[model samples]
Target chain A: MLHRIEPRSGVAFTLKRGQRLKVSDPEGEQVADLLAFNADDVDEVISSGRTLDYASRIFLTTGDPLYSNRSNVMLRLEEDRVGRHDFLLTPCSADTFRIIYGDEHPHRGCFGNLAAALAPFGIGPDRIPIAFNVFMNVTVDGATGELKVEPPRSRAGDYTVFAAEMDLIIGLTACSALQSNNYAFKPIHYEILD
Target chain B: MLHRIEPRSGVAFTLKRGQRLKVSDPEGEQVADLLAFNADDVDEVISSGRTLDYASRIFLTTGDPLYSNRSNVMLRLEEDRVGRHDFLLTPCSADTFRIIYGDEHPHRGCFGNLAAALAPFGIGPDRIPIAFNVFMNVTVDGATGELKVEPPRSRAGDYTVFAAEMDLIIGLTACSALQSNNYAFKPIHYEILD
Candidate 1:
């Protein structure tokens, strides 16, 4: 069945029995599709030496074959409560790490986190893909053509689940605490129900 | 006077006054330029409201034209501690926001921050620019050609400072939260020095 999160928000497509979702973030834009997987699939992937971790409300899933370089399924939603937030693009690079944390330690940065997520598979900084900031609401300046960032319309606890149609690697960071606005230094929780 | 930050592991350059510093990602895909400016010039841009704020680490001086987008400068390095960090590139989107403060409210994402920063100028999501993840150390997998994230080798207080040779609006965030991984959330500070 297909579900909608808000009256005018993004749309969500649920997988039915015997249906499979093919997802991909082609162009590294950070967008994904949907699918339904059981614990066995999750265990099988992990047993193959993959890792999935979470922080605060964000979940980072990493593995092989769920997605490919040229064209691959980035993520598949298994379940979703906040459909709009489910496909929200990953946060942009600059804004992700510093906003959460203060400027106490400028030396320590997110480059490492990004590297760790991709390095295991032999991916390097040059090949890092452009991610989609799914579910996040952004606006642009009409006259000046400037981009603006803002809090999403969705609230906390809202989520979407998907099954991997291909092997994929996703990374999540709670975000540091340095922003003058928005949440700072609060712990968010997430779970992977295979 | 000009300065240079030698790469601890790779090539480094020594910069002289009026000499420009151009830095690219490790793989040499993306690049950014940096020029030295006096405190007076930096302050003029700030006083003119061309740039938003300044950090103490940066210095502004006269005789330098704060370039703008089309006709205005997007960013101005009003201060600097050259050699501490190279003006290689801008921060990542998520890290940019985290440096601003999304960690406290783990549930709240960086989108709001992006909005807040852009709202003043009437910019919106549609206008949000495709930002570059500067100075981040990402690795590409040799086998699968996948990108990975990693912690930066930059030390505490190591910063990448530069003037907006062109008027370009920028969004920044500090990433790297344990909530995302095992990396502890660290604070990042910003100063608008004149």
Candidate 2:
């Protein structure tokens, strides 16, 4: 059975070691923010620095291992249809809106959504780290080190497969930031595979 | 009074709002990892994403405001003798040494130093986020998005002044990673200014 994550919403669940997760962009240009924490030790959460440092690259894809703070492999990217992803960015939140868009009343973005979804698992907002932004297009100007967020290049039905290297608590979101999805919202489709 | 953070060590203290803290490299080619949290609420901590987003640039210098995750200004770079700083990478840890350097018995890097120094304030290892790396030089290849850590250009006496925008618990470290400090660990000097 496939599970659907509503637009701007999120979900959290445990994935046993060796399990695979297929996250799909049913609607083209949608973004998903993914977080992983070791189920046995929540303190050992994913570390973007460790992953990027080991890979020596910012763009990660198939065969890349996602590492935890304790130098343990938590997940591996087994397959990918969209190659552009962002690990340098934090999930958008109410603060993102208020600060960037100047919105007085803002909707809870992916950060808040993840906080709510993962709260039942005993994870608090403070524990959340920089997420692996799936299908999110971000570019850095090398000359000046400026960052730009652009619409994703993922086509409809494009997906990525992640193989759990350890028992993991996974939190995934259909990103809510307008710029991340080109100003439109769409649901995310995901399925667990043996 | 001047405070000295010994090589490969760290210190944590409070900076009242409107006060300024000057961090200096007493010896050349050193790196300092700095972390800030709202003194009132530890959950509201420094955010690299918010700061980079608001500034639209990764190389922060004088006049750039360091933001909290809540989108509030925590500190502003009032003066910078070394213009290049890194908000992109994370503080090195035992995991970094083990994973990157393949060290069997790795020394606890900045992450562990900060954890020990900040423990008195009730902050845990899990709560630590990516720190603002002072005097650390990192370059990215635009074509490949690969990262390269280079020796810092800051000479002896190079310093930066951060004016607190809010009451903050500040953690500062004389980086322990050999690569970050060009293989020589040196002391970091700091002073509070009215």
Q: In TM-score terms, which candidate is top?
A: 2
Cα error, candidate 2, residue A23 (Å):
0.8
- Give residue B104's error in model 2 in angstroms: 2.5
DockQ of each: 0.02, 0.62
lDDT of each: 0.29, 0.90
Residues B1-194 of candidate 1 have per-residue lDDT tens digits of 32222221111122233323323222221212122122222211111111111121111232233332112343434343322221112222243334334454342222334445445544443222222223334332322323334444444444544444432333333333222111444433333222
DockQ of 2: 0.62
Off by over 4 Å in 1: A1-69, A76-80, A83-104, A107-111, A177-181, B1-194
lDDT of 2: 0.90
Which residue window of length 10 is worst by lDDT in model 1 chain B? Answer: B44-53
Stretches off by above 4 angstroms in model 2 are none
Strongest candidate by DockQ: 2
Q: Give the distance in Å from residue A16's predicted Cα in candidate 1 to where it truly belongs.
A: 19
TM-scores of all predicted structures: 0.31, 0.96
